[model samples]
Target: MHEMSLCENILQTLQQQANAQQYSKVKTIWLEIGELAGVEADALRFSFDSVMQDSIADQARLEIIDIAGQAYCSHCAKNVPIQQRYDACPECGHFPLQIVAGDQMRIKQLEVE
Candidate 1:
């Protein structure tokens, strides 16, 4: 799964931050993941534990914050919440709403020692 690679990248980032901030351990990781990011949270959690084994973030608690997707509907001339990429505008039932947010995955906060 791509979540394995994503965890690897997270580990790499943690290692780099550890060096820069002079922290020795990571206690908790708070991740902000958008609904449209296409990442499976369960898969990511499993991969994180495997990837962080014996590393600075070993045994770290992971907290995932889900972000709702947002889109602008040209037909309705308003912004609306969306669950999927191809969701139609709720007000006007227009196809292909322009995405305005909820397409990112990032580390929001970290508790380190």
Candidate 2:
């Protein structure tokens, strides 16, 4: 799954942050994952343990925050919630929605020592 690669990226970010912030170990990672990002949470969790083995973040707790997908509909002229890409606007049933939020994954916070 792509989650494995995503975990690798996360590990790289952790390593870079550890070096920049002078932290030796990571205790926890707060990840904000958007629903529209198309990432499976269970896959990410499983991949995290494997990717973190023998690393500074080994055994670190992963705290995931699920972000709801949001978009703006020009036809309706209002913001609406969406579950997937290309979802029809709920208010107006229109295409070509302007995405406002979601569809991204990012590290929000880290607890390190």
Candidate 3:
């Protein structure tokens, strides 16, 4: 799965941050994942634990925070929760809404020791 590659990226970034800050070991990692980002949380969690073996982050705790999808409806002139893109706005029942949030996968924080 791509989560392996994702974990690799996280590890690489963690290494950089740890080295930059002169930290020897990582204790926890906070991941912010968007609901519409299309990344599977369970798969990423499993992959994170599996890929961290024998590494500095081997014993690190993984915390995933899910972000809600949001959009601004032009027709309704209001922000609303979006379940899917290109779908009608729930409140306005209108299409062509501007996506304000969601579709983002980022590292929010890293706790090291």
Q: Which candidate is the best by TM-score?
A: 2
Winner on lDDT (1 vs 2): 2
Single out the weakest 10-residue window by summed lDDT for candidate 3. 83-92
Where model 3 places Cα greater than 4 Å from the true spot, the runs are: none
Error of 2 at 26 (Å): 0.7
lDDT per residue (tens digit) for residues 1-75 in model 3: 788999999889888887899998888889998887888999999899878888889879999998998999888
Q: Which ten residues in a row have the lowest lDDT in candidate 1?
A: 83-92
Give the whole-model CA lDDT for all candidates, comma-separated.
0.93, 0.94, 0.86
Candidate 2 wrongly placed segments (more than 4 Å): none
Output the TM-score of candidate 2. 0.97
Q: Which should have the higher TM-score, number 2 or number 3?
A: 2
What tens-digit string does per-residue lDDT give for candidate 2 at 1-113?
A: 79999999999999998889999999999999998999999999989999999999999999999999999999888899999978999877999898898989999999999
**Residue 3 of model 3: what lDDT?**
85
The candidates, ranked best first by lDDT, are 2, 1, 3
Q: Give the runs in model 1 whose Cα sits over 4 Å from its true position.
A: none
